[model samples]
Target: MTEPQGALLVGSVNYDDAEKTMRTASAVLGGRLRRIPDGEVGKRFHWIMFQPDVLGQAEGIERVGDEPRWRRDVDARPLRIADGVDAATLQLPPLGYASAAEDSYEIFRRLRDEGAIAEGIRFQVSLPSPVAVISSYFSSDDRAAIDPIYTAAMRRELDRILAAIPHDDLAIQWDVASELGIIERASGYGRTMESWWPGDPFDGLVERLAALVDAVPAGVEVGVHLCYGDAGEKHFIEPKDTATLVRFANAVITASARELTWLHLPVPIDRDDPAYFAPLTDLTETAELYLGLVHREDGVEGARRRIAAASAVVTRFGVATECGIGRAPAGTTEGILATHAEVASAW
Candidate 1:
């Protein structure tokens, strides 16, 4: 089979800081990556897990439990509107997405100027969809009231990021994980992810995500990462096939006004058969397809097997891990990066 070209870092590398993440990824991946993310270090090491504290800081919002819920070593308490406080009138504080991106972009720019990074590669900024955040952090009863407010706050964060970073060097990615749990009606991290709003959940999900896609200005590249919950390097539910992923990608493409630069889908490590990739033949959109087939355990041999399976349906694509390597075992990231470099030809 022909080697896939290019690679995508689905955000979060396990490095100690943004500078390390950028320098290491640039050194290891080189031209294979069209864009690079700043390891999502610090408080973002666990994606979206730091959000409850940020949300809890808002006026009229309070923590639901005295003790925090622990997951993967990070703790976060669920938040809700305080007693006698009107949810509709409440304003959310900054969610930290823009501040992180703006800060990281400086590192990215400095590295590029110093010739540590390639010129054409963009700096990728990954943001969680508001639905993913609202559903995960707020109770179902409080979701409807908090959704719009949070969404507006997130948009403002996006605006700040746009203002701070040059559009030509920017690429924005919406990380969509919890939406899959809701779509499959499965639970992740001991809680069921369900939509609080009435009506068809799938339609609502696609529309909301599409709106997010359109929120990015035309000059900046935008993409979507479709994921199952990756709480402990495990999906909330392993997919039966690529059927749902294909359907979701097609729907988002049709609903959105802007064109997607890329779309990434996860591939379970066990799925190396043609059956797992057959549905990709039905995908109608032309966005670059990235298959999350690189596994640290199996390395190049394993990625090759899945690549061969995917090649039967999709003629061209990129390679990535099923989820971010932020939570991967210590000392596994360099091997994972090597696997990507080996299986996929450098861009």
Candidate 2:
């Protein structure tokens, strides 16, 4: 099988759904913590490897785009614990999380190096927002200070790492959870419609993004993967018009990246209608749009109609599932990719 080149999912790192692929992987994830983190507090990503189908491309999800209201189960605990540190303290590597994160990345690194996914397919890496993590655990000042320090530090480390990597094949992404309206609500950070969710500690989110965008060494391109909330239900505040996209997406578009991937629900606009993304109708003219047209069971007919409908609104099209397939069964993800390729061909 040949590799797909035009902006398919490089791979999914964090699964929005809490479900893990195996009991062993789940045990490995659960083993890291001495105590569980609150549903509201944040945690790091699993080094989970998404088994790739050579004929497919993946989609992006913010984190958990659904399942937020499931009353916190006794079994479902938070991913980390209080370490008695201020927001700055939150940065000192959790009792066991960060080290595991690094170790986990090893599986992903090997897959890319060995061409397990797609030989020439572009691959990318991601992590949650340091600011979001700080805000979830500490106050605003602590959040402000922590993201910058981490941003500067991570930028330095990635500079060397990216330089050493084969940029033609690899890329990096910073998945900022602060912007995801649902996760923020659980963590008590921000709302969906508020222009700038007060106490919205992500002010540094933008700055850190800019710094990293500028600092990424040549040959490596950077992009952002944004999600509305952990799950479909978290998108509070009815989307009245395209203003939310105008406001939130503007900052992202102007930042140092060249790509913007968003979840697109099905709409009634005419397939021939000029008002394609009548909601995000006012997107800026710089980055590309990976119209999310697939979900757990969406099919080729539905996929083709919707993708064509969306492309009419904004052109630089890419076929994608509603979100990542990391938590979805490897077989389920395989079907999603097969459909994505079929739809892309139709477009």
Q: List lDDT for all candidates, in order.
A: 0.90, 0.40
Clashing pairs in 1: none
Residue 150 error for model 2, in Å? Answer: 4.3
Q: Which ten residues in a row have the lowest lDDT in candidate 1?
A: 69-78
Residue-wise C-alpha lDDT for candidate 2, range 175-263, written one tens digit per residue: 54445443234333342322123454345345555555555555665555554433332333323434444555566557744443322
lDDT of 1 by residue, 250-334 (tens): 9999999999999999999999999999999899766577999998889999999999998888889999998899988888888
Task: List residue ranges in candidate 1 displaced over 4 A.
Answer: 70-74
Model 2, residue 256: distance off in Å is 3.4
Per-model clash counts, in order, read 0, 13
Query: What TM-score would each prediction reach against the true structure?
Result: 0.97, 0.58
What TM-score does candidate 2 get on C-alpha atoms? 0.58
Name the best candidate (by lDDT).
Answer: 1
